[model samples]
Target chain A: MSDDLIGADGRKLTFDANQIRDLLPHRWPMLFVDRAYDVIPGKSGYGIKNVTVSEPYFAGHYPDQSIMPGVLIVEAMAQLTAVVYASAWKEEVADSDEVDTAGRVGYLGAIRQMKFNRLVVPGDQLILKAELGKAFGTLTPVTVQASVGNELVAKGSLTVTERGSGGGNGLQ
Target chain B: MSQSYDELLDQAQARASLNLRVKVLLVDSLGLEIQAELIGDDQPLFGRGLELDSLDTLEIVVMFEEHLSVTISDDDRAAFGSVNKLVDFVVAALGEIPRVEALA
Candidate 1:
């Protein structure tokens, strides 16, 4: 709630996990975004996911070596897109409480030109970014990229279908 | 008479080359199992023809932007009906590539 976290447009630029929970329906284990900042409403946004050894996937993904899965990295980027779109929706419906913007869901329709350049490991803070591309009817395409510090991890374009009244809360 | 015939032949070759390029783009980029030459110009690209889905269409959109330097909007979905239609769409979007450059 710091003034620094608010953009000049009066939109929240940073969101903690508790605030993210209100915009996204994802619970523990599935929710990949830990903290999001530099959010520009629906246009673009940035997020962070701190990969750690305590993650359940690391338990069996290789006890000796823990490499964060590439798909999960992409998922993190998608979640950031969700936050961007949901935040935009919340602004549009600020006066209405009957419509729950938090429940708005976006389903992954297609992943195009995805490439993984590096392996993400435990202790790495995955930085996720998404830019809204074009809207093809209900499907909104987003250009996404993820990196750990300066090392690029994954890049792709994902088309998410906005379902339900506010956009569904599941990835299909 | 022979001069006009040669011009017609040149036009035919240019069209054929454009069609071949479109087919190759679709097969190579989408990893379609069929041979590029086998994809008929008039054959449907979706459903019963090449069985292309929405994802394939999106990939094709990217392909058009990257390779052909042409942008295909959502309104242009009908242009993706077949190899011939796609060639026409690309040609139109590109404002007619010279016959020599197209064949080359």
Candidate 2:
């Protein structure tokens, strides 16, 4: 078995918005990760979410002060997780005749020890990161962090069900 | 050196309390509807017994790490078979069943 945590072949994987759309089930207002890079397949990756003034939530989240909701930051981290796992699945099926790794979504199993450091406002570029841990059956624990520039926005660990596990409780 | 009756009784009490704590964490962390006291020591944690799916396994793993300071890796998953099995793993890892009062 290969002992490398980061696969050499998958390290070069990157995703733009259109490529991310092909991998994730999220769309429109729900899609948080605008771009992804430094991907090591199922191991770890980084993503970017360009927080803009035109975001729908800013209309009411406080018309006066537009701070990005902390939950959305968590959701963005989850989406980046999907990219990591989905990209890994794609690598597994690369040589196969039927390569259908599109729209594979991972369900959030549990979020733990999340801490929001500072407020995320409009015109901020949210940098998201996730690193995979040992799997507990189909549940894989991911350590995630979201930041704007050099300032940390949120940091935590969360568990997500593996892709195609079908562990969804009819929420899909 | 042989052992006193009181010492043995205290150890037994600690083990019993540990079993209940494991059960309580399983229920609380997994968001199970049943009460902890209702769970039998020998009852299976997955499948037909507790009906816990794969998603709940990670919560139990984290619970052990955060509360008991025991790291249950995938290789040690046999500990997840039952409540008693989990407590036994913890006791084995810790080298003793720490008394509830002592833990406090």
Candidate 3:
């Protein structure tokens, strides 16, 4: 496949569902992001999620109104954050001969000051954006937002523990 | 002319107020279950005291930047020793109790 997805920094800027699958451990019903692009390792990333009526949550979310749950939008943003970190980690290990066979699994340390502006619905594509802040040890501070076109859907800051940091059943 | 006694008293009061603010900020930013007053002014922030880990340190860094308008770089790890140490660092950085408008 002649994939010219490299960005100005010579790092891969785009990832399709297949590429996303290789980085994230989430499977169907939990995997929220369909395409991730504009990924600047260790700094920022953007993602796209095409909302459809066929989503499992839509069946019981309203049963008639079909509004996407706000939490899921935040989840999509978190997944994009995972991409940002995982991509950076990949770059860090790229020059080494070591092969990392572990599937990336990140956990949310805390979801702080999240505000929802509008409800998402079928046919609306969620534009996910995440800006990574400073990282101390395994924890990184990230500001994330999800929007549908020009309308804002949700915005928040999250403390994300990097993949394989070993936090079992606890948020922090 | 040396500083007056009243001026020295005023400076001490200002430092104490900043210490309280920093303690309150630590509790609020870290989502600590305990009250701000419960935290001692000289209590060690990590290990044997508040038992804060690296994640909590990051939270404090963000909190200081947002609320105190002070940057806590890697070299400034010494300030994380205690609440008093953190307040002293802020006072030294800002050269005063951070003004109310600085809080975001």
Please state every model's RMSD to the true fold in angstroms.
Answer: 3.9, 5.5, 4.0
TM-score of each: 0.82, 0.73, 0.82
Better of 1 and 3 by lDDT: 3
- lDDT of candidate 1 over A58-154, digit per residue (tens): 8877788898888888788889999998888877887876556555666787776699999988889988999987665556778999988888889
lDDT of candidate 1 at residue A71, scale 0 to 100 = 82
After superposition, the stretches of candidate 1 with alpha carbons farther than 4 Å from their true spots are: A1-3, A8-12, A101-104, A164-172, B1-11, B97-104
Most accurate candidate by DockQ: 2
Enumerate the chain B TM-scores of all models: 0.86, 0.91, 0.88
Q: How much lDDT does each candidate structure score?
A: 0.81, 0.82, 0.82
Model 1 lDDT, full chain set:
0.81
Question: Where does candidate 3 clash, by residue pair?
Answer: none
Candidate 2 stretches with Cα past 4 Å from truth are A1-12, A163-172, B1-40, B43-54, B65-78, B89-102
Backbone Cα, N, C clashes tallied per candidate: 3, 0, 0
List, for all models, the DockQ compared with the true complex. Answer: 0.28, 0.43, 0.39
